[model samples]
Target: MEREFRICSECGKIMFEGYVIEGGWRYYCSDTCLEKNYTRDEFNEMYGDGDTETYYTEW
Candidate 1:
């Protein structure tokens, strides 16, 4: 299978393919941009199985 790639919206750097839990495609060159867009606490509140512990990994 061929993974799609794109440029990061914040830095304009090359981004690799990855699965998005909320659905749809996403392109982020680094964790910085990802975190900037979807914060850890916010993401856990939405996609997480009510487990806030995993949110700590964002840092």
Candidate 2:
């Protein structure tokens, strides 16, 4: 199997595992990174107004 590495959208850290990918397919290693990469307003604009749980859970 090939390894998958993702760079954190905020910190540019190389991630071998845990990921918090955004709707636009941006990769983040943690909630901190995700938050830093986007604001609440930006998230809503990109994903629409709704509970964020669904956003993280569905993927």
Candidate 3:
């Protein structure tokens, strides 16, 4: 097993792989963090603010 530590783009929380949200090529710890990191207009540009869903994909 491997442990990867990443800083949340919004709140700066320490997170592992399975606990995160993705938007605009960035990783956040939660949907609230994603929302905080981006504005309505900015998020709207990313195909609308998703239903606070966690996006899972490789970086």
Candidate 4:
């Protein structure tokens, strides 16, 4: 049982869920934070329910 910690690219909050977008490597703690950087349509085309696990963040 291993839970990874991640940081929200939008609010800089710590997240227990280790999910992130591929290629660009963008990460968000919630949909609100994700939507800030991507349009609804764009996000839909991205890695849904993804995994880029860790306590890492891309600025």
- Best-matching candidate per lDDT: 4
lDDT of candidate 4 over 1-59, digit per residue (tens): 65567677789898876337664365678778877887777766664444423222433
Clashing pairs in 4: none
Question: What does candidate 2's lDDT look like per residue over 1-59, in tens digits?
Answer: 76767676678887764434454367766667767767756655655554332144312
Off by over 4 Å in 3: 18-25, 39-54, 57-59
Taking the tens digit of each residue's C-alpha lDDT, what string does model 3 give over 1-59?
66666777767777664234333346766657767776646655554355544443333
What TM-score, computed on C-alpha atoms, does each candidate reach? 0.44, 0.46, 0.46, 0.63
Measured by TM-score, how close is model 4 to the native structure? 0.63
Tell me the deviation in Å of residue 13 in model 3.
0.6
- lDDT at position 38, candidate 2: 76
The per-model lDDT (C-alpha) reads 0.52, 0.58, 0.56, 0.62
Ranking by lDDT: 4, 2, 3, 1
Q: Better model by TM-score, 1 or 4?
A: 4
Candidate 3 local lDDT, residue 16: 68
Question: Model 1: which ten-residue window has the lowest total lDDT?
Answer: 50-59
State the weakest 10-residue window (summed lDDT) of model 4: 50-59
Q: Give the clash count for each candidate.
A: 0, 0, 0, 0
Residue 49 in candidate 1, Cα distance off native in Å: 4.1
